[model samples]
Target: MKYLETYRLTNLPAKAYYIPDFISDAEEHFLLQKITNAPLSKWTVLSNRRLQAWPTQLLKGSVLPTTDALPTWLDDPLVQRMVSLDIWRQSPHDRANHCLINEYEPGQGIMPHEDGDVYHPVVATVSLQDGIVLDIYRKTEDGKREIVYRIYQEPKSLLITTEDMYTDYLHGIQDIDVDKSLYRDTVANWDFLSDDTKQRIELSGGDLKRKRARVSLTFRDVKKVRNLAAFLQMK
Candidate 1:
């Protein structure tokens, strides 16, 4: 993946990349099917969205606490493809050990926040079903926050964030049905978007309405893992 540099969001911060059409249509459909068929108990419904944590959720919101590996469906192609980029080469586990499948319905969104230090600084996100705009924020000396950049993530795309881009800024999506003011000048990854996506946004007068729920698969390597060897021995 030496050519990965070509996908870097140069107009934005120090390190972030966007790859449009990272997965084929068949692959997206397959993943969505798997997620759809998962047990109802696996889903943790939240105020604005629903999510499933693979291999188990973090213990006390800080430790991975379980040694169980991600399921084959979550690992094989998605994580494997990320491995090719070497983004986890320096991570504690040298690979992603946790995956969060988050589903956001129309008019739903998350507030701006950082991933924190529980996991490695790198984060790999795969978008499915629909597209959305992520707003990046930086704090001013006056102790207030302001949006500094924006990213339009297309369906079947992969977005990687690390280094300064991971720690130096906050990222979030706005709670709106239609993402407005989208164009080359306002979006960090505009040049990397597919032609069809660009044309659609343009035809809508710089607005892209959200008609379907969007799912994001976020992968990261937790820095802390509890030993389950003794527990396994008794099983």
Candidate 2:
């Protein structure tokens, strides 16, 4: 399949690929169950959302400690598909070593921030449950920011961000109950969404309301890792 022909967002930055229904409903449900069933300690509570850093978070921006491979629930199908896309082929690892599972309840969203230097400049995020709009911003000379674009992420869809789009801009979700002012004119990937999604948005009079909880699994290749022994010695 020609990925570019499937979901093209020309108005935005250098690269952003949106693939609707990238996973089957059963796959989505299985992944969601795995996430929700994780030990309570797996979740780190934030002001607006909760997240689980798989294989453990980075240490000093250079190393990953946990040697256990990602659970099959997190690896199969999804990760396989990602590999097939060759999205991480150019990264140092050639495959994502970490996954950040973020669960956002209604009215909860993350602050606008860049992923920074911890991981390679590519992020492949898979959305589950409800859909939401990702707000992209451009940095200004004075350290202020400006809203540059919006990308709608639907359930079971995959969004890949790379190149200048990843390093040169900041991305986040707004803390709002409803995503308003949605239309082809405002949504950067409006033409790429599934027909059902587009129809629903149109039926809602161009404003998409958020009703269910949403979970996003962001996959990235962490460039740093130390063996368990070395990591333990450094601590």
* Best of the candidates, TM-score: 1
- Per-residue lDDT of 143-171 in model 2, one digit per residue for the tens? 89988899999999999999899999999
Q: What TM-score does structure 1 among the candidates reach?
A: 0.95
Tell me the TM-score of each prediction against the true structure: 0.95, 0.94
List the candidate 1 regions with Cα displacement exceeding 4 Å. 228-235
Model 1 has an lDDT value of 0.90
How do the residues 9-94 of candidate 1 rate in per-residue lDDT, one tens digit apiece? 88777799998888999999999999999999999999999999998888767677566889999888989889888889999888
Q: Each candidate's root-mean-square deviation in Å?
A: 2.6, 1.6
Model 2: which ten-residue window has the lowest total lDDT?
Answer: 1-10
RMSD of 1: 2.6
Deviation in angstroms for 41 in model 1? 0.9
